[model samples]
Target: MEFAADVFPGGPSDPSVLTQYADHVAGSVWTGEERLELKLSSHGKKVHSLGRSVPAIEGLVIGTRLSPLIACSVDTGDQGLLSSFVERWHRETSSFHLPVGDVMITLDDVSSLLHLPMVGDLHVFQPLHMDDAVQMLVDLLMVSAEAARAETGQCRGLYVRLQWVRDIYKRRCHAGHWTAASREYLLHLLGCTLFANKSATNVHVVFLEALRDLRYVVHGISYTT
Candidate 1:
C-alpha cells in the first residue's frame, strides 16, 4: 500500500488519528517475538545489556500549540529501533505547531535522545513535494518557537528561524525554482502569516496561520493535479 494509504487509507476526509497510524505501522511488520529477535540480531550484545526491556510498543501524538499532545511510551532495549522511531516521529510531525516533548521509546534502562535540528534550514531535509516541504519547514519553526519560549519564556530566539526563512525566500525568488502558483502561495504565507509581527506569546499564531495556508495549497494541488 502507498504511504498515505498505509497511514490514512481513509483519505483526508477520514477522522483517523496519528496514534492509530503509529500502532498500525509498528505492529504490522513484525510480531513481538520476531521484533525482539530482529533487534537483538541487529544490535548484538549491546542490545542485551541495555537493562530491563520489553517487546515493542508504539504510540501516536497530536495536539495544538496550547498543550502537550500525546504522551506514550515504548519498551524496547534496541537503541537502533528507538532512533528510527524518533526519526519517523520527526518526519510525521514536522508539519504541526506543537512542540513535542521527549517520546520515551523504551521500558528498560535504555533510552535515546530525539532532538529536532535547530540551526539549519529544515527545507534541506524536506521531501520532494514542494507543498509538503514548505509546510514541514513552517511546522519546524513553530515547534522551535514553542520550545524556545517554553525553555526561556521568551520568543526572541524564534528570530533565527524567521531570519533563515527570509534568506530562503529571497534565494528561492531569485532562482525561479517555484511555479507562479507556488510562488504566490509562499509569498502570501511569508507576507501575511510568518513575517508579520506579533507578541511573543502569540508567536505560535504565525505558525498556525502558515499551516492553515499550506493545507489549502496542498489540497488545491491534489485536486487540480
Candidate 2:
C-alpha cells in the first residue's frame, strides 16, 4: 500500500496536496449525497428589528463599544459555499486547506469585518452556580428571583432563552427604565450576534458579567473565537 512521493508530496503538512485529494474524493468518488446544512437562526434579524424601534441609548451603547454592531445586519449568505469551506477546515493546522493555499482567520480579520474593537482585555467567561446565576439574572435583567430561577433551570444554569430577553426588552426599552433597558439590549445584542450558538434559542448567562459595568464593555473586553 505504498504511495509514491508525488502523490502525497509533503505528507500531512502539505495543504495543497490534501486539498486536491479532498476535492477528488468529494467531487467524484464519494458516494454520499447529503450535504452539510447550517443551523444559523434568524435571531440577528430579530435583534436588528427590535433595535429599530427601541429608544436610543447612545451613552450606554457607546460605552459598551457595541454601537457599530447595532447598525449591522446578519446575512447568512450562500450556505453551500459556507459548508464547503467548513469541510475544508483542518483543526490541526487551524486553517482552511484550499486550492489557493492555507488560509487562517485572524483577529484583525474579525475586527475589520465586524467593525469591532480589537484592543481590549480578553473576554473570558466563568461558569456560575445555579443560585448565583439566578441572582445575577434578577439583578441585571430586573426579573423576579422566581422567574430567574425557572429560566436558569431550563438551560441548566448556563443559558436563558433569547425570546425571553426580547420580551423583557419590549416591556422596558423606554426612557422610564433606561438603565435596565440598556442591560437587556446589550445581552440581546451579544446573544444574537457575537456569541450566538447553534441552538439559536438561548444565550449564555455568563455574558451578564459584561453588562454589570457598561463602562468596561468596550475597552475592557475583547472576544476571541
Candidate 3:
C-alpha cells in the first residue's frame, strides 16, 4: 500500500493526520533483537596510547595548535535518548521539533564545543581514481605502491584502515622519522575525531593532502569540519 494511505487513510490535510503519523512512526520502531546495534567509539584510549608525553610528539601537536583536543573526551551518552531526538529531527527545517521548542546544533556550537576555528575555505573533494588514490597514499604515508594499492582495494579506493595509519606511526615516530610520524598521528587524529565514520575502522585518504604540511593542519580542520 502507499505509505501515506497506510499512515493516514483520510489524507494529510485531515485534522488527525499528525496524530496518525506519529502513531504510525512509533509502531514502526524496532524492538529487542530486531533493533539495529549502534556503534560508538570513545577514541580516548587510542589517543592516549599515542605517547603524547614524548617531547617530539608533544611539540608536533602544539605546533599544529591541536593541543586542546588531547584532553578532550567523548561520551556516547544514552542511545535511546539520542534515538528520540533523531525521530523529532525535521530535515525540511533542519531542527528538532521538540515538545519544548525547535532547536538545532549550529556552526557556532560546533566551533565552541570542539574549540576549532570556524572560518576558512571549505574543502571540496572530488571522485578519486584508484591509481591516483594509491599514488597519493604512497607519497604521503611513504608506503610501497603495491601495499597502498592493496589497502585501497579493501576500502573501495577512497579509504584505508585507521589501524594501518597507527602502524605507520609506530614505525616512524622516532628520532629519524618523527616528521612522518607526526603526519601519521595527525591523520589518525582527524579520522578518530572530525571525520569519524560509522564503520569506525576506516578513514578517507583524501585527508592525506591536508597533512602534507603541518602548518595547514588547523586551517584544514577549520574548513573540513
Q: How close is candidate 2 to the true structure, as a TM-score?
A: 0.78
* lDDT values, one for every candidate: 0.30, 0.72, 0.69
Assess the local accuracy of residue 214 in candidate 1 as a C-alpha lDDT between 0 and 100.
35
Top candidate (lDDT) = 2
Q: What is candidate 3's CA lDDT for residue 89? A: 62
Give the clash count for each candidate: 1, 0, 0
Could you arrange the candidates by lDDT from highest to lowest?
2, 3, 1
Give the per-residue lDDT of model 3 (tens digit) for 34-137. Answer: 44454456776666776463566678768777666666657777988777866666444566767787788787876688776676676666667778888887
Worst 10 residues of 2 by lDDT: 22-31
- Residue pairs in collision within model 3: none
TM-score of 3: 0.76
Query: TM-scores for all candidates?
Result: 0.20, 0.78, 0.76
TM-score-sorted candidate list, best first: 2, 3, 1
* Residue pairs in clash, model 2: none
Regions of model 3 farther than 4 Å from truth: 1-27, 30-34, 51-53, 90-95, 222-225
lDDT of 2 by residue, 1-225 (tens): 123445453234455434555443243314465654565466657676676434456577776668677666667778777777766676555678678887998889878988888886686677778778888888988889998978878877578998888888767864357777888888888888788887877998888887887877776555675
lDDT of 3: 0.69
